[model samples]
Target: MRVVIALDSFKGSIGAAAACAALAQGWLAERPADEVLLRPMADGGEGTLDAVAAALPEARRMPVTVTGPAGRPVEASWLLLPDGTGVVELASTSGIELLAGELRPWDASTRGFGEAIAAALDGGARRLVLGIGSSASTDGGVGVLSALGLRFFGADGAPIPDGGRGLPEIVRTDAGSLRLPPSGGVTVLTDVRNPLLGPTGAAAVYGPQKGVRDVARAEAGLARVAEEAPQIDPSTPGAGAAGGTGFALLAWGARLVPGADEVAALVGLDASIAEASLVITGEGSFDPQSSAGKVPGFVREAAERAGIPAAIVAGRITGDADVSGFAAALSLSELAGSPAASLADPTRWLRAAGARLAAYRTQDE
Candidate 1:
């Protein structure tokens, strides 16, 4: 039997590579002769950089010091692929997890990620892959644009403050000092397809997740930016990704693509699924949200489309998750007794879950 394992990181508990390795070990323990392949997966979120770097061994990690989301100095890293493609993930520097305390929806910035992008450009990278997921800011990516030489001015022509709080004050902007990639173009990878403003857009749909209580303010801020720049299509799909980071990048001439689909293509997931007898995928949480562009959801869908058996191994499987695409599912939290323990040591439980799946067809039956 041939099996392919493609799993996203378990977040704080484990990375994509480690999770795939542990799962493979457990599956091999039960089916020693079965062919198993591991494919790391991400949706432009937390593990995007790690997944990309793991997939490409020749990628170099270039470090740059930049401002963190909370206005602190932090040394962050971006990937420089052997093909002169630079990979930048927003979660590394401006992610929500970096916030130690309360979420600063009004003050968080993507300035750090912007710095990384600038460094990659300075290093002569022509093609850029930007993973704009799991951001901490509701600033509509003004901070990022500012870092790239786009100047925002208020009614008095003064520089706008950082974060969403400054968006409303912006009356004008200019990109006179902007620099373009080496004509290879920039690709913005994201899972979200929400627009830049209104109810289903960036602020209303994602603000609450970032500890924001006033969705109206965030919406207004993004709207203000859109109003200032009529050329930016606020209603475009994916404009809401990364707290309107997609919108900002689009204004700067970046193309938005589905992160999981792009990553899967880059890693040859479609071919792997077709060649495998069983396809397995997973994530930290398999919930309603996972039904979208998340790894487990689309991976299972792809396997089903290819007429292959598909299963999922998630850290926690919510009861309401749409698991119709999967033939079976397993949860580390259930296998390890509790969510706390499962998270504290995901490797052991992930292996156990994998073995359990390996033995699912047998089980002394």
Candidate 2:
């Protein structure tokens, strides 16, 4: 039987590729005669670039140094696929985790992400794939736009400051020096669908996580940006992603696509699953959000569509998550007897989960 194993990163623990390898190791130990395929996955968040690099053997990593979320220099890298498609991830450039638990809601910036994109363009990337999840700023993407030569000016024609605090002073935009998108254009990947402003939007919904104690101020700033650029629709789905980075990219002529679906297609997941006897998918946590544009949920749905039994292995299966769709489900946390123990050595637990699942499959067969 052919078994396909695809899993997202276990967050702060093991990455998707490592987790998949560990699981495959255990599965093969029990079912040595079975064919196993590994396909690491992500939803355009923290581990996006790693996932893509793992899936595409010919992809190259280009190093870059740019402004971090907290206005510090950060060393990061973007991916260049064999097809001349450059992949830039915001999480590695201007993500919140880079701040080391010191959130910067008001002054964080996405300038680093833009710098990485510019580097990719300079390196002759024919197309761009940007993963904008896990952003650390609410600057309405001004920092990124600025890096790409889209100037934001105040009433005196002086350049506005960087970050969310600068948004309220924007009076006009000048794209005079902006670099045009390549022939293949740009695709922005994100799982979020919230608009740029309002109760369900960027500031109101996500600001708190970034340490924005005054949501009203952030909202006003984003609103001002929208007003100045009426040509760009603030109400567009995903416009609020990465603290309005989606809005800026849209203004720069990029289209927003669902992160998981796009990554799946890039990895040819459907084709892989069609020939598989069983499919196993996983993530760090199996929660309500897992079913909403996340990798494991997408993999499971694909398996269901192909009339194949799908199993799931997660770091922890949350109480409210719906797992009825999966043919078999296992939690590393449960297998290890505690969340702490499971996380202490995720690969070990992942392997055990894989072995148990393989045993269960054998009994069913």
Candidate 3:
């Protein structure tokens, strides 16, 4: 029998690679003869670069220092796939976690992410995969465009400052200096499907979590950009991803793709699942939202199509979580007897969950 453990990062607990390893460790302890395969995975968020890098050892890391979300210089790296495809993760460069205790929802920028993309393009990558989850900005990706050589000039002809605070300044954009990845262009991975400017847009939907008191102000900032740049569709689904970073990339001729699906394809998920007797996948939490471009949903759909059993092991499962498609569902919170206990150490709980699931055989097998 063969088993495949592919899961998204457990967020604060551990990365996708470590989670898979822990699960594999427990499963193999029970059945040593079982050919266990571990595939670290992500849905285009914080661990995207690490996930892809772990899966493809052939990928080379391209490290560079760039401006961070808060206007400070920070070190960052992107991955160059063996096939000349570049993987750029916004969370790595401009994610909310970088700020730690100093949340700057109003002013954090995406400049660092764009710089990493530029580095990959300069290194001869023909196609680009841009991940825009876990942002710390509400600048409608103005700083990203600025880093990529698109200048924003105010009505007085001076360049605006580098954050949402500067967005209200009447502006004109110059994109002539922008260099695109060969003809392959860019595919942006977005975790959300919200529009660029609205009540449920970037600011209103995600600002408070990032520590903002004025969602309306952030929404207005993006609105100004929409007025100035009619070519950029403000109403497109996923335009609100990463505080309008998705909208910015779309304006630059990139296609918006669901992050989980995009990553699964990049990591050759189906090919691995094809030979697996059991498939295990999950994330920090399994809820109604997991059906929306999350790793678990992707795994269940793939496993069902391949006629294999798929199980979910997560930190917690909300009451509304739909698990009808999975063969088995395990929640660390329930196994550990409390949410705090599970959150405290999901890696251990995940191992126990894996061992329990190993007892069940794939229905199709």
lDDT of each: 0.87, 0.92, 0.86
| Pairs of colliding residues, candidate 3 | none
* Per-prediction TM-score to the true structure, in the order listed: 0.95, 0.98, 0.96
- Candidate of highest TM-score: 2
lDDT (0-100) at residue 293 of candidate 1?
81
In candidate 1, what are the lDDT values of residues 276-362, reduced to their tens digit?
988989999889999788888788888878999889899999999888778788989899999999999898998898899989945
- For each of the candidates, the C-alpha root-mean-square deviation to the true structure, in angstroms, is 1.8, 1.1, 1.8
Error of 3 at 240 (Å): 0.9
Q: Is candidate 1 or candidate 2 better by lDDT?
A: 2
Q: Model 3, range 1-365, lDDT digits (tens) per residue?
A: 88888999988788999889888877777677899888888888999999898888899999988889998988999899988999999988999888886988667899998888888888888999999998998888888888888889888999888878878784687778876555788999877899998788888888788886887777778898878668877889999898888888887888999998888888888999998888999999899989878888888898999999898999888889999888789898999999899888877887888777775553334
Better of 1 and 3 by TM-score: 3
The candidate that wins on lDDT is: 2
10 residues in a row with least lDDT, candidate 2: 224-233
Cα deviation of 99, candidate 3, in Å: 0.7
* Model 2 quality (TM-score): 0.98
Instruction: Judge candidate 2 at residue 10 and give its lDDT.
Output: 91
- Candidate 2, residue 325: the lDDT equals 95
